[model samples]
Target: MANLRPISRVVQGQRMKEGAGVTICRTVGTSMLRNLDPYLMLDELKLPAKAAFAGFPDHPHRGFETCSIMLEGKMEHRDSQGNHGVIGPGGIQWMTAGRGIVHSEMPGTTDGVLWGFQLWINLPKKDKMCKPRYQDYQATDIPVVESAPGASVRVMAGEHAGTAGPIKMRNPGLLMDVRLAAGANFTQEVPEGWNGFAYIYDGEGKVCGTKAQPEQALVLGPGDHVVATGGSGPSGLKFLLIAGKPIGEPIVQHGPFVMNTQDEIQQAFRDYQSGALQRPEDNPWKGEEL
Candidate 1:
């Protein structure tokens, strides 16, 4: 028996322009104009064979973290810390913007086509300003273990069965990039009280018993395990299985700013307006972001 997992309507990814890049999937998340706390927002970017679609110029971030994962092509990241590198295919870069930081992501070519995923995870209020750090985990550095007949799980956070990922953080969470071949099914447990959700990337499947398509998402009820079964794609189904322990605090976010209070959000805007938010002088790619 499967529960027709509760889900919102499926909407097409719209054309939305952001600071440095364009957004295809518009109107994301549950509420109309509000973002899910803890998990702010998730957007998808697809770049064709050409090189014109390179992403984000130098940008300022306060009180949040930005995650970039190259799904198809290559993405080069440079920041104020004087760090620069290319994340290809399965490579991922997790950056934390505590008090403040400035950085940029420029899309690149690989073979011919280019594709990837950029995820943003919110930082808890207490740990928000700790410090800014960059962790680039090579594809091989990420652990991928087989769980069931036709399913594979890539553990990015939290414990999966007996395996864990190299990408550790202060936030108690789990991020698994899972893939399922047709007819294959896999079930992995989640923390007893962890807040989690599953979003389909390639194919359709049943989420805990409800039917979900690549066009839709499953918010998932309070549970311990997420079940994804393959359906249509002979090419196989891809999804990002992510979960996080709730921080249980007020979230204040405005555009690129994410904080815990209205005063903090206002301060973030003021800082950026005063040019204090950009990467400092003598920093990596100084004065590069627009």
Candidate 2:
């Protein structure tokens, strides 16, 4: 029998304004959750149809990566490296701001509701100054597996079951989008010594016998596997199961920059201000403009 993980801590997302007056439900990076090893922050951006909100404009980042998963509507991304793309529903854009990069994520449609999640993954000290790159995928690019009756899993990164996700990162991790029908259950095996968590986004469910509500992030304790059961609601249950191998390094963050030391953080700011953060010649994005 697999050793089931227990819910170590439950963090309620705090609603706060971000970008250009857009509200976001932040689960990690808050005072309640602080930082989670290799994972830094997770934000749920939900813009209603009636809300007049400006999206995130050009911003700089360094020593980390940003993964954006679009669930509804569309988002356009443009970066200082001359990379441009649009992620529609079910699409994902993973950007590695290794040395540094300035990017913008704006809503592609103003008439529809926009919903998505952005997760920040920290890079180790060695890879922190590496070259910047992007790994983008359309909805069809991601592999989905129906592991059990009424349960569907989308493998976004790392391996799940016998299938592997398309994106590769400096650090090994798992980012799975799971959905369960009423009364259905799904089990996932996590690697030993990895930090993991689940963020419930729709309906209600149970993680290791603990009730999970929307916008709640449940931190998992040491175990070999995790179990999630769907509630009897019409929408069933939808959540993101994410885990990463801990970097075990000191984290010094200043706004969009994340580095190992205070001196590195200050250097990141100086590089951005001096227009020396990104190397245009080293840009790995070769796609056509959207």
Candidate 3:
């Protein structure tokens, strides 16, 4: 029998705002659960359809990567590297701020729903200052697998049913968006020693036999797999299953910069202030395409 990992801790997200005026629910990044190995923060951004001018503006990040997933609505991304693109519903943008980069994430009106998540993934000590890169994909790029009737799993940055996502991470990790109909059940195997957790964003469900409500972050204990079942309610359930290998290094973070030491964090700030973050030759995009 497969060992199901039970929920060890449950934390509720707090309402917060980012950029100029975007509202979000911050699930991670708190002092209690500051750093989850290679993973850092996870922000759930849910806005109204007319939420124009309510998005993240130009900002700098170094020694880490930002992975944004669009569950609904449309979002446009522009960066100092000259990368510009628009990701619609179900699209994803993985930005690697290896050394340093300035970027903005603006929103556009689409349908009635405007929901998304931006996950901050920490880079390893060796790859902290590597060259910046990006991995952008559309809704059709990701693969969705059906485990059983009324249960679907969308592989974002990991492997599922022999299919793999295109986004690559320096530190091994897994990200999956799952949806289950009422009374449906879903299970996924997780590698041992990898820190794993689940964030329920919609409806009700039971993770590892523990009842969970929306906006709850469930930390998983040591086990080989996790069992999640939809609640008896009519709305079903939706969540993001995230797991990553622990980097096991010193973590020094200040605002958008994440480094292995305080001196490195200070240097990142200095480089940004001196405009030495990105070289002219480093940018491959020339306002044509991203």
Candidate 4:
């Protein structure tokens, strides 16, 4: 029998505004939990219908990967590498900020609710300076499996019952988007000893014996399996169950830069300031205006 992992802690994300008044709920990257190995931070961005969401402007990042998943609405992405894309409902954009990259994410629509989640994943020390890359997936590209009536799972970055996410990662990780109808139940196993967490983005339910609701984050203990029960409501329960093997190394993070040591962090800052972050020849879109 697979033992169910219980929730060790439940933390409410702090609400804050960033990037031209864009509101977000930050769950990780806080004082309470600096990081969870390969994973650094998770932010939930939500904007109501008809309300203007002044999106994020150009920003720099290094030594990490960012995964953006859109649950609803639309978002436009433009990067310094001349990469441009838009993510709609059920879309995903996974960007690797190896070395560095400057990008902006803005709202594409104003008539409907905008709901999405952004997760930061740290890169290994050796691959910190690798070439930047992107793994974009549309809704149709993701595999959705109906485990049972009223219960379904969307494979975002891990394998489940032969369904795997399209995004390729330098480090191994799992991100599963789950949804359950009222009176439903779902159970699954996570890799033993892996750091695991689940963020309830919609509805209320019990995750691994802990009462959970929207905006709540559940940190899981060591065990093989996790159980989720849908709460008594029409919306049921919706959440992302994520886990990753801990990198087990020292991490030095200083505002947009996550490196292995203080010296590397300082070098990142110097490179950005001295215009040495990206060499002209390295740019794939150097001569193009984007």
Candidate 5:
């Protein structure tokens, strides 16, 4: 007998402007759902094809990791550590801003609509100052598991049906992109004490017993697994099921940086202002071509 997770609360994503005036739907880092333990923020990018966008300019970050999942468009990333890459549809770029990092992500497509999501995951105190690294994967690089008759799951971070994601991280977590046909059911095991949620993006569905719609995030309660049923719509349902172990530490965040204390947050600012946030010697990817 498996314990099914229940929907603790439902939060609708709020529209906000970020980076260089890029419109995004923010779900996790808002007043509705402040912070979810190991997860800090989740933003959905939906830019029109003909829209004029400035894109995200150079920025600094620390004490966390950022994962960009491109669903329909392309994004180009370049960091101070000399790591550069372009992730297109069905691709992911996972960057660990351990000690510190300065980077920029800009639109890589001009004539096509840009759609994606950026997730911010917190790092534990022990590995907060570790060396920064990146794990990028193309669509074909990731593993997909046929979970049910009409359900498929793309494992992004953790194991699913004996298949594992390509990206490696300091923290243990699960990031999955699930697609379900109409009336189909899907289930996945989640750690008992982990905090997690599901963000519906494509169609409507029922998470456990609660009705879920697009742009709605269902914060889950304690359980050993989650169960969901696809909507009756012609397009079916699509969502991102993300869960992670709790860091259980004080979070002090200032704009792009997140630390465990106010003093550390201030120090991050000082380091960035003094142009010493990321040391030159610490950049192993320097001068390497993408």
Candidate 6:
């Protein structure tokens, strides 16, 4: 049995403004250290309104894959592949930054609220130089299973109950968006031994034999499954459940680039500044006429 590792702490995320007027929780991305190893960073971007969250400017990346899942609004994306489109509710844009590429994300709607999470998953050492690719999973592509009568699990990786996840990776990780009504109880195995965590997005619950109140994110040491139980009240319970194998390597991070060594990190920055990150033909097309 995977050790029943109880939650150690509860850290909540707070919003802050950044590039292009994007508002997001400053803490969640930085606090999830190794909760999902191989998957290095996660930023929860939530716009109070579409006008306020204009999205981000064109950017360069290498040695990582960006998993952008939209929970509320839409995000317009374009890349060097001449690919241009929008990913809305239940949608995901998995962009692999093997060698490198330039891309941009802009808000899709002119009205309404915009909310989503961008998770940066790490690639293995051997695949660092692989060519970049993007896999767009439509909302219909993801499977939703009933974890219980009123509780369900949206499996993104690994497995949950009898359903297998659609995503494939060089790493062993699991991303489950769970929702349970008040007074509901649920349980599931998280492999034999894996590092796991829970970020409560709404309502409240208990995990690993401990309580996880709203706005609190809990990190588990080592465990098989995160057994959660919700309470009876005016609110329901919702959270992000994640698990993965540890990379067990040195992490040298510089801004958006996450590598295993300080030298590699420096090289990444140099490549970007020296105009060596991408080829001219692969230059990402700029949509707007300035």
lDDT, each prediction: 0.68, 0.88, 0.85, 0.85, 0.87, 0.71
Off by over 4 Å in 6: 31-36, 280-290
Model 5 score (lDDT): 0.87
lDDT value, residue 88 of candidate 6? 89
Worst 10 residues of 2 by lDDT: 281-290
What lDDT is reached at residue 10 by model 2? 97
In candidate 2 the C-alpha lDDT for residue 237 amounts to 88
lDDT by residue (239-287, candidate 3, tens digit) is: 9999989889999999999999999989998999998765543454221
- By summed lDDT, the worst window of 10 consecutive residues in model 6 runs over 281-290
Q: For model 1, give the 10-residue run with minimal summed lDDT.
A: 281-290
TM-score (C-alpha, index-matched) for candidate 2: 0.96
Q: Give the lDDT of residue 15 in candidate 3.
A: 82
- Candidate 1: residue pairs that collide: 58-289, 71-116, 73-115, 190-224
Q: In angstroms, how far off is 192's CA in candidate 5?
A: 0.4
Please list the residue runs of candidate 4 whose C-alpha ends up more than 4 Å from where it truly belongs after superposition.
49-52, 278-290
Itemize residue pairs with steric clashes in candidate 6: 190-224
**Backbone clashes in model 4, listed as residue pairs:** none
Q: Per-residue alpha-carbon lDDT of model 4 for 1-290, expressed as tens digits?
A: 27778898887898887777877898888776778888899999888834536788887889988999999999899877768899989999988888888889998888789899999999888788877877788999999988878899999888876778877877887999999888788887787888889999999988988998998889989898888988888889999998998888899999889999999999999988876654433554232221
lDDT of 2 at 162: 88
Stretches of candidate 3 exceeding 4 Å from the true structure: 283-290
**Residues 84-176, candidate 1, lDDT per residue (tens digit)?**
888878888877777777777776663566666666778888778656767787788788888787778888766666899876566777788
lDDT of 2 by residue, 57-97 (tens): 98899999999999998889988877889999999998888
* TM-score of every prediction relative to native: 0.86, 0.96, 0.94, 0.94, 0.95, 0.88
lDDT of 6 by residue, 228-286 (tens): 77756556677778777766666566666767778888888888788676454443332
Q: Which residue runs does candidate 2 get wrong by more than 4 Å?
A: 49-53, 286-290
Instruction: Kindly give the stretch of ten consecutive residues in candidate 5 with the minimal lDDT sum.
Output: 281-290
**What are the RMSDs of all candidates, in order?**
4.7, 2.8, 2.9, 3.4, 2.7, 4.8
Per-candidate clashes, comma-separated = 4, 0, 0, 0, 0, 1
